[model samples]
Target: MRPMPHDHSDHPHALLPPDPALRVKALETILTRKGLIDPAALDELIDTYENRIGPKNGARVVARAWADPMFRAALLEDATRVVADLGFYGRQGEHMVVVENTPQQHNMVVCTLCSCYPWPLLGIPPGWYKSDAYRARAVREPRKVLADFGVTLPEGTSVRVWDSTAEVRYLVLPMRPEGTDGLSEDALADLVTRDSMIGTDIPKVPS
Candidate 1:
């Protein structure tokens, strides 16, 4: 009797999925073939996101937190609920927690298991954020990673790393920037960067 066709589903190689970039490339190829998208249009789309969505949204959240103590308290206590209160809550961010950074303590976040993140408030995770290099090195060498990101903690400040898992997501509520005292919430939000929301960068001073 002839052997049945081999089954590969249980194989170790089969257990690993293809890279997401491959899927994106396949989709782009299909779109190009169908004449639905041109190369220039695709480049423009990428630029739109690079300039607009992620960092800009994060800056808005930070600015609001700085101007309103009550809102800040709500954000720290329950990030998802508070963010939803501002109309930013959505699919991936049904559960969220905001960690506060202080003079004595600094917080950094990572998804050691997977790239689980609060997407609604922060938008898409940057390319580097989802890389194995970042995930492996973040927990293993947090201070060095923060330094590379241009964030320097004080000599005595304690570093706290929050590892986001599938069940819960996290955001970092950075301390309010100086020179932003009299800025309105709308004006302040523009200074917030996605990095600050993730604890990698701090808000820039208003010029």
Candidate 2:
């Protein structure tokens, strides 16, 4: 729907960062000069993603699934329909797939072809996600990538790398952490991070 999401790494003006902050400012200036966007409105939209409409939405879905076995079953069975029903489908997120990370298996996602991602569910993709280094290394060395993310699994644990395309995007369903037995849905949601849903990390147990 959004012009077949692909890597713009080759674009001369593509935003890659040694200084993402400055790049953002320059892009904003150009767009403003072109009168394509209102700075005030743009700031508001950025604020929405930063504060309100971020991974919090996906966290709610994860939290609900953790608390309700029925919902979890339905989510795993039909991620596209179930997530759309929950109002998390848009653009690159039109085709949703939920891959669960089990005690014996871990799932991580990469867009080897391009940076296709579930933006509606995960909000903005992290800068590292779009880097050529990440897109390339994630598939070739997922365990190493996970370790860089501070996740070291047991030797017996198998890692699965899923590649996203223009047709489909994936969300990793991380296992609920231990010691969350008595926590409410909201409490559990707080423990879910964007990295956890991407399979690079697991939900943290609050101390």
Compared with the true structure, model 2 gives a TM-score of 0.80
Candidate 1 C-alpha lDDT tens digits along 1-207? 987787656755333346877767777787899999898988876775566445566567777888889888888887777778777766567888888889998888889888887776777798778989889988888889988888888899888888886667788888887877788888888777787777777777788
Q: Cα deviation of 149 in candidate 1 (Å)?
A: 1.2
lDDT of 2 by residue, 62-169 (tens): 999999999999999999999889888886788899999898999999898878778889988888888898899999999889878999997788999998866888
Error of 1 at 128 (Å): 1.0
* lDDT (0 to 1) per candidate: 0.79, 0.88
How many times do residue backbones clash in model 1?
1
Question: Candidate 1 local accuracy as lDDT?
Answer: 0.79
Please report, as a residue range, the 10-residue window in candidate 2 with the lowest summed lDDT: 9-18
Worst 10 residues of 1 by lDDT: 8-17
